[model samples]
Target: MAIAGALIWAAVIGTLIYATRERRRVQSEHAAGLLILWGGAIIPALLLGLLLGYALWLMPDIRPWSAPGEPAGLRIEVEGEQFWWRVRYHPADGPPVDAANEIRLPVGERVEFTLTSSDVIHSFWIPVLGGKMDMIPGRTNRLTLRAAKTGTYRGPCTEFCGTSHALMAFSVVVMEPDAFRDWLADEARPSPGAGAPGGELFIANGCPACHTVRGTEATGAVGPDLSHVGSRETLAAGIMPVDVEAIASFISKPDAIKPGAQMPAFGMLPEADIAAIAAYLEGLK
Candidate 1:
């Protein structure tokens, strides 16, 4: 179309020049006719450009992998925090798996995400696959995305949450349906008990003031609900991994892992206590 438009424009210009050269007796009329012709052509092109731009702006995001019905495979809760993201995968047929920094979705299946925040406002965005949705405290926002291709996509917090906001990022892994099911099954199995010291320290110290565990007495909601913390992929709001060592270090000093994080450091605890806490959290998966 652009090539055709260029050719037509060239023809119009050539016609104007030819009329100017051939019609000396009616030069004024020829010039007026040329002006009118050019004006008429230019107006429509400008209007078409404007319309196309407007359409692009107003178009809803297109995710090629999404099936055209309610998502049937998985529902994940993504909570944005200052400088990080918390990911929770709720299996359609099994229990939820909690993690930080990473999200997994089944290829060719629709996945729904419910976004929320623990503190200030944030926006969730995955550019290649979906649109941005705000995560406001005390309220939930919904976003749906599907990965037509089996590869990793990077996502970040489009809304500035805090100082370390630039570090707020996560990855979505789109895998085959069977592989995703296997991963969920593995995450569901309980971890062996080896984190008793950490569990005891979690209670002895004041970590339960702002977190929660569904089956336990620690039921605080001021922070990200930690009922399934061990199963999560990231922590400190997608700022760090949810592994035993990372959990231990984060509990020892959250500020070190995520600057300006609201969680206070518990480095004063003995190494054994921190390890125990990390072990217990790892078992939550």
Candidate 2:
């Protein structure tokens, strides 16, 4: 971008200087026409054509390698929903680890993302990590990324999905290799202990039909997994900080937090019950 900007400014400034200084020197009408052809048309065309050719040569490599028994690198599947990201880490030894919104990857490793959409076309973009890839419904797209540094990067849904598209965002946390392995191991485990309030409520209140809290009987795969939901930094696709209060509010009023969210508002539940559910979810970590 800086190079392009410099070239554009250089062209504009050179034209301005030449027009003011050389206008009087060019006496013949034919010279002006020739100048317009070579300077105005030919030069800019060649410059732009070269830029286009370079971009085409450097187009982001997007080949879906998330299929079974493929690509020796770490593979992840991401499903784009209306206002959130459903993530799955394919592990060799056990069931796929289910997560939402945030992803933790090891630094200096090639990570392949298999992107798809459940409802609408959404673009997955983590600017500092790699190029953008579209997630189209019924179609799978892919992007291979390599993060050089260890830090948190923003992942936002670039394609305009719906009313809540602007709020659809996540975080990519790059950690050391050993740290990431430990984290992934931790993530693959089931929810620890019995969720007294939220566990029973989540099961009996029909929440299990859509969400999965591993280790318990709430193993529904329709929505984001809540096995480690309390450990996330943000709730509702980075809309708010993760806390028991926010979780309780989001549980009862998802529509209020995300205008076009798919989760139906559980406004009918009593405030105490909602708090209990939130408290239980908050302790999963």
lDDT of 2 by residue, 160-279 (tens): 999999999998889998898888888888757445656788787889888888888888877788888878878888778888899999999898888977788887998888888889
lDDT of 1 by residue, 1-285 (tens): 587578768977996787678545755788777777766677668768876987676444333234479456678898887766677888877777765566778898778889899889998888877778999999988777767888777788888778878778877778899998887676554333323335666766777787765545565755666655666556655566778898889888888777897888988888987888887877776
Model 2 CA lDDT for position 174: 92
Once superposed on the true structure, which residue ranges of model 2 sit more than 4 Å away at CA?
Answer: 1-4, 21-24, 27-71, 91-95, 193-197
For each candidate in turn, the TM-score is: 0.64, 0.83
lDDT of each: 0.73, 0.84
Deviation (Å) of 242 in candidate 1: 6.0
Off by over 4 Å in 1: 1-73, 90-100, 193-198, 206-235, 240-248, 275-285
Candidate 1 accuracy as TM-score:
0.64
